[model samples]
Target: MTKNDEKYLIEYINLKRHEYLNDLQVLLGYAQLGKMDKIFEYIQKVIDKCNDERTVFNSDMDSIMKYIKNKIEDK
Candidate 1:
């Protein structure tokens, strides 16, 4: 790919990464509020979106979701 194309891809990935992080933050907020159902629902939605998009960060998403699940269970 051309440098310009690579640059665009990098930007797109960064934007998506930020969006995912925001979702995780929201999930954490829900968890802190003791909204277990909301936490599960939100995480499922994230997983669904990642599956649909087939993004490069699917593994990262899985790892984060697992971490969140463990945190919830620990509480």
Candidate 2:
């Protein structure tokens, strides 16, 4: 891939990773509030959300890398 394409991909990945971390922090805040049942419920939701996000990010990054590989091959 070209230098610009590589740079853009890195930036996008970093941005998404930052957002995911922020989401986890919010969920952790909910867990720390001393409600047993509610904390478990929130933790479960966080687990599900993290799983979904992982799948999506993996798919997206896979696609981006494939596209870059194709571009490099074409040149």
Candidate 3:
């Protein structure tokens, strides 16, 4: 892969990781507050969104990554 491709890939991964980290922070706050019901609902929402992503994208790792690369390059 080219240097730019690698850079874009890293950026994409970092963005996704940042989203997950935010989710974790929220979950942590819920845990600290002993809000089990909120935690459960939050987790369910995350799962549903993940499922929707899979259905909408319909991509494996390689193709999804190519799509991401194209998008990053387009911007």
Candidate 4:
């Protein structure tokens, strides 16, 4: 592929990665707010999306929790 094409692909992947991270953040926020059901439902949606894409997104709860904690602490 051309350098320009690779650059565009990188940008696209970065955007999608950030989108997934944002979704995870929202789900974690819901979980912390006593909305376990909502969290589970949203998590299932994330899982389904990952499965359909043949990708594994953050299977480790500790890492996921750490990311959320860092985001919360950053503010």
Residues 1-75 of candidate 3 have per-residue lDDT tens digits of 777768878887776687789999999999999999999999999899778667646967667667667656665
Better of 2 and 4 by TM-score: 4
C-alpha-based local distance difference test score of model 2: 0.67
Q: Evaluated with TM-score, which candidate comes out highest?
A: 1
lDDT of each: 0.68, 0.67, 0.81, 0.66
How much is the lDDT of residue 54 in candidate 3?
75
9-55: candidate 1 lDDT, tens digit per residue: 56665666778789989988998899999998988998897686554
Q: How many backbone clashes are present in model 1?
A: 0
Candidate scoring better on TM-score of 3 and 4: 3
Comparing 1 with 4 on TM-score, the higher-scoring candidate is: 1
Top candidate on lDDT is: 3
lDDT for each residue of candidate 4 in 1-75, tens digit (9 for 90 to 100): 556545655665666688788997898799789999999898898888768544322456445444444444454
List candidate 2 stretches off by more than 4 Å. Answer: 34-75
Q: What's model 2's TM-score?
A: 0.46
**What is the TM-score (0 to 1) of candidate 4?**
0.61
- State the weakest 10-residue window (summed lDDT) of model 4: 53-62
Stretches of candidate 3 exceeding 4 Å from the true structure = 1-8, 60-75
Estimate the TM-score of every prediction. 0.66, 0.46, 0.64, 0.61
Ordered from best to worst TM-score, the candidate numbers read 1, 3, 4, 2
